[model samples]
Target: MPYPPDVERWRELVSAYFAPEDVNKALWVILHESGGNSNAIGDSGSSLGLFQLNINGLGAGLSEQTRFTPSENIRQAAIHVATTNNWTPWGEGALFRGEPFGSLGNKPYPGDKKNEFAEDTVAIPGQPAPPVINLEDIDEEGFELFSPSGENFEGQFDGYTSNLEFAEKRILNLVLEHNLSFDPNQGYGKTTTDELGDPVFTLHEEANMWSEVFFRSEQGLERISALRDSGLTTAGRKSAEAFLDTSILENAAGQKNFDDFRSRIDALAAVENIPIQRATDIASM
Candidate 1:
């Protein structure tokens, strides 16, 4: 079968639905094996889709009816890759092992040694490629951590403002209101100290709360910038900066506000034909 001219589109669709970085290699291998065509449903009975997924284990969230659709096929294939090999850029080495030249079969007209390759010889390109399969990465133990499903102290503050000061106030108030033992002398710094005269907010507890605050709010970046301006410690600034630059914030309807913010920034930069650097400097204040 001739390869699809729209292979790149198919690749993009699949990558979007699954792992973008590793999809190229997976597509390369699958193309080598199945000629980029979804196997006929009847040919392998239980097998379906581009990667020949068994209907019973379609964990990729692909419906059997859409098995042949290029996008669906790629999505399922990518999910299969993730599940079977733990396809992450950081764990590729452990996920694949080199095999003998002919181990993957020579049916694809295996010829020159340089050109001919084994199934596992292919590699995923990108920084910090998926890690080799590690037991630590897999959660095989049946033990499940206690996760609250209902609204509680943590739930009430989820997606709350990213400002550390706000977070501190909330923690302090919660502790006092609940009569929890936390020290007040420790202060509401990034590190949560039991100095609040409370056991509820220990050092580890403080760290986790700060993490949650940063993860949930856009103000985290501004807070970090403010901290830097005030000559405060930069211990957690790296993550806050990165999150501000790359993460997207959304409204109740899921409309992204980052683009709007960026546009406003750009407009401020363009005002009076001010240079972007100068505008950014002014806006930072």
Candidate 2:
């Protein structure tokens, strides 16, 4: 596999799927690993493709065949980065993280290495990614968090922690309510959907809404962003990043991993005193 000839596409994806800092860092990581070549293979035969990811460490759902596609390679790399802080698995060190880039692997004490990434990092390989719910299967005519019909998922909103999935869904629904929402005109912001609607956002805007609503606090956002920046994803981080975590192009356990993350969110939200509904700004953005 050659580096994605269309580096910009991958850049946009990274920007869309990851927090602000992560977008640049992920690209920098590839800059070091494959020189951004999607087709680049590692000197070590086991590694292949853009990020030079080893098939062995790729975890569940992905296989050798995925190497040929630049999109999957970048996506998997971002996931791996989100799961674990630092680019160590990709053969880079915490050097670009303001530490020395070289000799990172030779640091000697593997266990002693402090991941030191912010708390928001999210990555759990044992569990599969959330199931990629087919947007086509969902009703587009109108949006509803609850309804007389069970198909509308009336129970998805179980408050801050348990309703993680619902939050993501609602963000999408609200964004789709073009008649009801407007854009963030804030001039600058993180995430890909910064400029969605005049009042409400769509696409990446939906994701930004999820990121904020789940965390429910500035500290929460930073901690989660730190986690994302460092490349680690815990249950809480996953909960916060769920919007970005579930990409349409990838296969997800969909609802499978949602519970674990929600549980984590439950515990943390209790401790943090985060409200079930953080704010309605996303809807009115």
Candidate 3:
């Protein structure tokens, strides 16, 4: 059966985190949990979002606003499923244990929305098992994956290290071009001073820290793009963009004005037609 538009979107999100075969199973759990509502709150508001994540327990450290976001909620749920290799966290999991990737269509949701365990056999009696497909082998064409795989799925920081390196090189050039004063006598850049008071400044470290500011702004743009693609509200996209624009000024190369920094880099990138994923990528390059 075809899912409703919103439900299909949630299924796509689940596919982003879980293996292709497991997507249906995960979505089945989602149907019972939140009914495909991204903003659904249950368990007296303690549990929030699509999977009805418990904020006090598994959903700890994430803000309420974040939990309400569909992408994040699905990602967290997928992480739990991957970690335990079982859907044990949610109440629905207890009902369908042992055979994690079994055909969910056969196991209809209990008439009531209540998550109750059934004394049914682990696998459908005498049924053939589902084929095991590795997550990495799946050709996810349209989906923009935030994480590479479910196994040890850390949040994606695709070009962070390279961005830092590029930023450091740029900063070194900037420091040299601008001739920013670093008093060797006072030991300015966190490295030891030579006998002649010539300081060996670890400018790379400074560049690393400074580069993070730009990287964050870049990451914010990526998230905003994802949000737009996901059909998030204009107000939400604007709010996120506004925050990113404002925050970049605080630590971006000691620049007081956000517009100056952003515009300058953007203008240059535009001229060259560089497909920049990170701000520092074009800026430093």
Candidate 4:
């Protein structure tokens, strides 16, 4: 039989009402309970199709007859589940997630394991939380990853390692020292309709790029500090500062910044009568 017209509509409605993370899981729950058969009736005879809705003793949504409507069933169920994080609405199926139900969807409510962890670790009393991260975004070796295929995922993780790893270390230190949120389940990774709690990228590589920017900027600031500390002539320090000040750090990065920073180091080295390598090395510190 053709699927009920209500399926997509209900999914749309659920995505709008709940977090994106809930929509897929809710759909999978429907898939398991009804096999996407809108007319499916449980052996218990009370539960209806899609979300196994029992309009009879259910909430103030529809009647038993209307419960068979796929979209209507999903809408009611999603709204009900939105009120609480309880998956007992799924019965024993909640305990055993596998095929037919698809991947175990994340908990939708604030109290679910993910949200609880986010709250414990991510929530900032006076500020917004940073992008949420998942255990899936990392590997057993503690490397941030974008794909699940180990090192063989898309793009060159190893190629980006030196810069990527350095950036990762800096950002991670920032997050931990500042008590920022690294919670994997921030009610993210859902379809477009769901509420994105904190900022998160869709790909691991993109996240790495974001971290790289911060690391580079920190390095820029260090260079400025170095010029100030070096015992160079006044003109030399001013030249270095003018060449590698905050503007260099804030502007769009390119080869120009590198050229300018290197030039400034050279000038400082010449003025101080030190080897350019030694002067550059001191600034790097």
* Predicted structure with the largest TM-score when compared to the true one: 3
Clash number for model 2? 41
Whole-model lDDT per candidate: 0.37, 0.43, 0.48, 0.42
Model 1, range 217-259, lDDT digits (tens) per residue?
A: 4443443343344332233333443454454332211223334
The best candidate in terms of lDDT: 3
lDDT of 2 by residue, 88-115 (tens): 7745666554234664221121122222
TM-score of structure candidate 2: 0.35
TM-score ranking, high to low: 3, 2, 4, 1
Q: How well does each candidate superpose onto the true structure, as a TM-score?
A: 0.28, 0.35, 0.40, 0.28
List where candidate 3 sits over 4 angstroms from the true fold. Answer: 94-285
Task: Count the clashes in each prediction.
Answer: 23, 41, 0, 1
Cα error, residue 12 of model 1, in Å, equals 1.7
lDDT of 1 at 6: 27
List model 4 lDDT by residue over 136-158, tens digit each.
43344444432211123222223
Candidate 1 CA-lDDT value: 0.37
Better of 2 and 4 by lDDT: 2
Residue 111 miss distance in model 2 (angstroms)? 36
Model 4's TM-score against the true structure = 0.28
Candidate achieving higher lDDT, 1 or 2: 2
Please give the lDDT score at residue 29 for candidate 3: 71
